[model samples]
Target: MGDVVRAPWDAYFATGFDTCSEVLRGRNWLAPDFAWQERQADTERWEAVATQEMTKTLSRLNAPEHTCQRRSLGNLFDRSTVQRLTPQVEEHVTRLLDELADKLRWGEADFVSTVSEQLPISTIGSWLGIPPEDYPHILEITHNQVHAQELLPTKEQLAVSAEATVQLRAYFTEMVRRRRERPGNDVLTGWIHTWDAREPDRERADEILYRLTMFVTIASLETTATLLSAMVELLLREPGQWKWLAEHPGHIDSAVDEVLRYDPPIHINTRIAAEDTVLAGVPIAKDSMVHVLYGAANHDPRRNENPDTFDIRRTGTHLTFGGGVHYCLGAALARMEARTLLTQLLKRFPTLRTVSPAVYAPRLVFRRVTSLGVAV
Candidate 1:
């Protein structure tokens, strides 16, 4: 079969590395923005508050709107910001690892719960000035809300996502209101001030700020958690690699990149054809939807020498964080979190081993590992 093939569901699946790269980097390929949503025949699905809100997010918008919204938080995960935030990430990783060690002393510990899940939210929550008490609720709602973003969400999943979206909207709305009333030296408060200065209408400005805050917070949680967990899982599954990485801590960055290529947090990204186009000899009509399978592309033999093998020192690129315009804004932060956690984790527990095979949630787009039992 060729690189681009039509799936049973009617959408095209770009499986080859080159095909996926072309789709992502091409100017004609667009995110499923509001206009795309409006054009869809399934009016009811598009009308849901969750779907509507998702389309408005920076991830879903296109062209001028996406450019404008992204520009607002452009430098958020830049080199300087990540460098400034590294020490904090390290601090959290150290504390979480200590807690994990305590749990391991008693018995096998769930690394997903103790470390992977905690570090991302803790780092982002502190940065956004959200109270630590609220992290659990935010995590719960974010988990539910992400179901709506799946490649083929069922009725049940959409309902759950809608409910979660409502809760999230209310939660962020109130949080923005409070921050506006009592300005804090936090990222959210700073955004509120910036939007207030830009937009004349207070209500509109608040809405923009709330959406931005909700997206920023939600975007960082589950994906980064999955990255951290998968990184540990991959390393532990290979004892020699783990030992080598522990001995040579400088390879942690490459190790993290290898894990991302081997098992990315998100496997599929949907893009619509802006105009008539042909990919890998397959003619695609205007407005056609293409599902870029990142996992498949990453493992394509044409892309990597031995795609099945997890080699940390391999020098190649993966579309894990996507490519071009809609590439993940939190990529740098996520990498930093993974690198920091792995660096500290290897240093702390060189003999760490997996208690059993990892358990994963039933998700297509987002690869969520539900549990990873480990012992030191």
Candidate 2:
């Protein structure tokens, strides 16, 4: 659905978990095309690695292995874990806000480049067992990996950009191996044991590993960073929402949701037609590349009243995280990070405000507030 991201379109076998949930009532899919791709082999090209190699990783959110992994790991995002991470999240947020306040004391600062990016990168890196010292590198790799359009730089060039990813995968592979030799407490260690125990097939473990790495690789930072930047942009553009959120404090969850609907982090995902079908009466042939216009779909008047309006108190859930069996595995973790970051940002800097007009790439596939200067 992008204006021009053709060669490197990279349509994920992704799902709008909620979208499917809405249409199917917890039983079906939003589009038949999406359901077909859910079982396709293309996704296996990458996901196979995660499930096959990682041993413990369940590639499918609906699959039994994934269910077990989700039960174990998903608990990390539940109330107890969220409660546990709150203090640490706040402490980290305090450091960032203080850093921002310190810098703004001198002059204007690019908050998106400096602050928004830092929050998710740190949170995700910690979640993935990456060291603090390497977050900058992680950010660079994830950033380039997502934007590697193969336009100026061919797929080969894009692959070169993913050198860090290669290194990252190699590192994780070693971690998985070491854990097999001697276990530990981190999620990585847990994943290794799970992967080793499942032993679905000889190659299954590698596939699982790929899926697990890919799970956190592109989605983690891209979703969080883009959403955070969009939050700053919307809050700055709409003084009322910003003021309301600042005052209510508890409305941070609503603010996060509104931010997602107003300017979702991801805008487009494609689905291959399962067979001949119709989308809202439009004939769709089998194997057609059907673009899911999430941004437009989220704002469809049929779905939301005054779809364009940004109301933090808006009660309707949106399609930012997606729907169905393919729903984002990281949804809970992401929500917690957003709630924590926004809370800390608002609390520390009551005067928090963007100082520059945000810059966004016209790229339609992903909508990220690339840069937003701010004043504390």
Best candidate, lDDT: 1
Q: On residues 345-375, what C-alpha lDDT tens digit does candidate 1 reach at each position?
A: 8788988999977888999997888899999
RMSD of each: 1.1, 5.7
TM-score of predicted structure 1: 0.98
- For model 1, the local distance difference test gives 0.89
Tell me the tens digit of each residue's lDDT in model 2 across 8-102: 44332223333323432233222322244455566533332222222233322334445555554444456776677667666777778778888
Error of 1 at 153 (Å): 0.9
- Report backbone clashes per prediction: 0, 34
Q: After superposition, how far is residue 201 of candidate 2 from its true place, in Å?
A: 6.4
Evaluate model 2: give its lDDT.
Answer: 0.61
